[model samples]
Target chain A: MKQVVVHPERCVGCMQCQVACAVAHSEAKQLVPAQFESPRPRPRIHVGAGPYNEGFPNRCRHCDPAPCLLACLPGAITRVAETATVMINVDTCINCASCAMACPFGVIRYHEDRSAQAGKTVAVKCDNCLARQREDGIPACVEACLSAALTFETLDAAYKRQTDAVARSVSAVAAAEALAPGWALLNAHKKARLELLTSPAPSDEKRAAGNAREDTHVRHD
Target chain B: MQYVIIGNGIAGVNAAEAIRRMDPNGRIVMIGDEAFPPYCRPMISMVLEGSVPLAKLPIRQASFYDDCKIEPILGNRVTELDVDAGRVDVNGKHVAYDKLLIASGADPRPIRAEGLELGNIVYMRTEAHVRRMLDALDGGARRALVLGGGLVGFKAAYGLMCRGLAVTMLIRSGYPLSMQVDAFAGGMILDTLTAHGLDVRVDIAAEVFEGKDTVEAARLSDGSRLDCDLVVIGKGVLPALDFVPRDRIEVDLGLVVDPFLQTSAPNVFAAGDAAESIDVARQARWVNAIWPEAAAQGKVAGINMAGRTVPYERSLSRNVIRIFDLDVMTAGVVDPQVITGAEVITRFDPATRHYRQLVFQEDRLVGMTLVNAIEQGGVLMALIQNRIPVAGRRERLLAPGFNYRALA
Candidate 1:
């Protein structure tokens, strides 16, 4: 399943993606009419400015072991098995905010809309534009990215691109070494790069080992 | 290999699932005292409040046991555990096991007062208790008196109030939820309860019950008698370890288990409220009776029982509850007296009923309490669990826009 992946380096902080998300979620599905619609539509994504004028768009990652689904007392939240998209049933939700508190990303919002069940507030979060995906095969946020910062792709494709970028950087350095007139040094560097590229990627066991080391100071009873 | 599990609560069910994942063909037998299938115990209050139907209580469908190939023996109590013989006596039948797990859970503490054995007194622990309370309400029992100001007591009081019954709560502590929250948060809870027409009296106790056959009134420690038709005892619960022999296993407030959830007896394990494991924050062996910890411990125990070695990490104390429109959450060691060199930061707005307090030991966050605005609860718990150093970020910890991902 493909998801909208945000690239912080290319984000220009225009918030057009957010606006498009709100419009896509609205009853009218249009920008001008959605502003005056009853119970104003809320954008599922948020763009925040960071240090040194860097901006990033933050939304739900749709975690595999989603905490929001676990924390929901009434069992209103569910995950689509085929797409792995986390969603909430608004009609069954009691608006208790347990999911809001459980979400680590702070993307879930508790919003009050008069048009929804006579002014009852409910938790709202990104559903990855489920309706649009079924129709257009892409999320509204990724479709609206002006700088092409967001890409809708599968996990395998994303990781492959990242590895390819790393390989390109290593090859570029090797070519630069070859131009410096040191054949032996360049060959040694090429051999090392080949071994690095051929070796299997890091696994969760390595991550767990690092975690155990970091937790040495913790007093275990 | 055959695995025998006692109790059908969340912990036991989770253990069964974990065991099935590892050893697919193991003969599994589960015994539970309750007649019904496993349900979410924490939602008992919601069940009492009539917000949720009883049909939706089961955590899994009836086909789950069949799919998992588990033989369930419900509505039967285990009478004895013969550890030496590798069997448990249930209703005069000896059930043998290669490995045994005790997840019997806990039972509500009985109210000990004169005339306490009256007919109308209800102890909220199981589904039967909730049914009896609902029946009493149906039979036109109007007024109720709840003893204890803790979580169970308040939930019972609130449930009774929702059922159109006049409720009067008496607490022995200075405020409600003394063990979980600070005085400020407790005071706000008291205010909320009082505003909602609940007669919440703190720093008081019910000394005696006056009645002919059923409870008609309760005499207070302050020498005052209040008329009541029903008495609901929500004083909390104690670990149910009476079925185990004292000489066979080590027992503290609960059954003592090691980091691997193994008891003194060979091939025997315990989890849930019945097992006393390590408390990470206090560095002590104690029964932290909460749902999340119990489920995690059950998983760890099940994995180990299936020939895989896994250590059960100690869990910090945590709770999230909503009382009549107010949201409150607590995590880690909230008591000021527990930690040495503790620094406290607090923000309270009585008008909006929003309160936030963070407790720090040196530079690490040890505890936190949030009311109304609690989106930071998961982040706070992660910080406490990871022992993140918050040296100069104390203010950021309390900030409304605190980003938890930044810590990574």
Candidate 2:
């Protein structure tokens, strides 16, 4: 599942990330004008209340299959093929706000005024500072973050983390077997028997964790 | 009230001009550290490149100051400023002021390395710098080594190249102008310099100078050495704030000024390189050391000093450069971290070695790096300056063909 992993414990609540976001959206490439001239700059990635009193920022979790991407009737949101980062197209946004409503994370916002040419409200959200990341090593928010709270990791990196977790599980099994070889064999047999007694589980994580021998037995049958 | 202005660079002259407009009858006294009049610091690169002559580099004629009824105090060093007395001592002579503006800009960072006091070693900042280098060049100096790859170093290298000297630029970073542009853009600049027969090295520092009186050669970190007759150290400048106290004023990388360009002391102001104004767009105080911003800021300082309550607000860090033929421009907060996601429009023809990149974070143009396509710089700058909300996906701005309707 593709998602953003936020550690609110790391957030200092500097709101430099917010200022960076506003600058990303602003025409002047800065946050100018009196505070009253514009709306309190809406940041797509918000530094929400700290989780577990950790005190950090939050944004779209990008659910397994993002509900916001699914709910967009105008097709303004698309995942980048290279990095799978979600990008929002301003022109295609009809201001239906269905995406905003569907976003479980509430990451999307519609502009108050439509761009002159598009004549339709534009949708704003984080694009991962794609250009800057491609040019520089880090994204603007991550670069500007004095606390070093935010980061961007590749999909391969996430896959590695899960796979490493699985390796640890396998190593744990090996350690249990070393302590009592005969007992370990008996436990494997007991696990195989339990699989036969219970109905096939649906959760993929559990299924991946299940004995491979059971699948072999089913295939033979 | 007599307004006494010290220093005569872009910042000082700009303040003088602004004060003349704000208080026509107010006796304005302008003191300059340099003998020459106000000129653009940004043009120093062009000056070294020989594109602009020394005479033409000045923004206004010396007569312009006299025409405005501003007394020009040239070649005088301001020894002290008595904050309590509201007076400045120039060459031990006291000049009283109802208000004092300190625009004494920074000097080139001194070279602490041994043999730096030699005849051929130079630091490019004023006309004397160019004249000194030219004097050596006239004396048949053949090889030149520039110590930094920033704007100053690059310009110095370019100028030396114009004089038919073999030029080499040494940088401690991986690429040139790494502080301003990205690696890709920096590489493009390197290509331009190399194409012009200039040797550029990154990740290398000037380890040692080999000569005694007039420097002869330089040894690099890689154990390689280059023969050099002239050395121009373009190391960055540190703000000259010796006259001001730390407690009375805030000092970050530059002096901390409020939106009004006022220091902590009342009736005391600062402008140009010395004052660190807030980059209004970023909502952060940063040193805007560029030329146009310095001029605009000096004007604002003057306006405020003349009893106009105009709080100077808008500050966008903008700079455009044409290295060889590559047009590079970046404005506002051009940090890599801000670009969360972006769409790029690129047109690269390998045969010509030309490249153009317009980086958009979502639909807005947050940062851009361009090479060869010099003309598009203005349009992208306009988008950044206008804060133009992009209409479509970022790809629209970066189409295969040029369509400037996005600018409109």
Top-DockQ candidate index? 1
How does each model score on lDDT? 0.78, 0.65
Model 2, B1-408: lDDT tens per residue? 899887787777767777888788999988888877666565555556665566556656668678879877889788877777888888778999887787887778876565677789989987788878878888889999999987678778877887789998888777677767766667777777788899888787777788877889888778897799999999878777776767766678777788888877767888877778877435468787766566667877888888887786656565556554565655554445544564445545565455545556554665665554333344455465445676633433432222232222
* Per-residue C-alpha lDDT of model 1 across residues A1-221, encoded as one tens digit per residue: 78778776566668998999899889899999999987898888887543222346778888887878766766678999888899887766766666765676777777764335757677778888888888865899998997767899998898987776666667877555433244334435544654455457654222222112222222111
Which window of ten consecutive residues has the lowest lDDT sum in model 1 chain A? Answer: A210-219
Every candidate's TM-score, chain A alone? 0.74, 0.58
Residue-by-residue lDDT tens digits, candidate 1, B135-207: 7887778999999887889889988888888999989787788888988888888888888889988777788
Could you give the CAPRI-style class of model 1? incorrect
Candidate achieving the largest lDDT: 1
List of clashing residue pairs for candidate 1: none
Superposed model 1: Cα runs more than 4 Å off: A8-14, A48-56, A91-96, A111-122, A147-149, A164-221, B405-408
How far out, in Å, is residue B110 in model 1? Answer: 1.8
Off by over 4 Å in 2: A1-221, B222-224, B338-354, B357-364, B386-388, B399-408
Q: Could you estimate the TM-score for every candidate?
A: 0.86, 0.61
Count of backbone collisions in candidate 1: 0
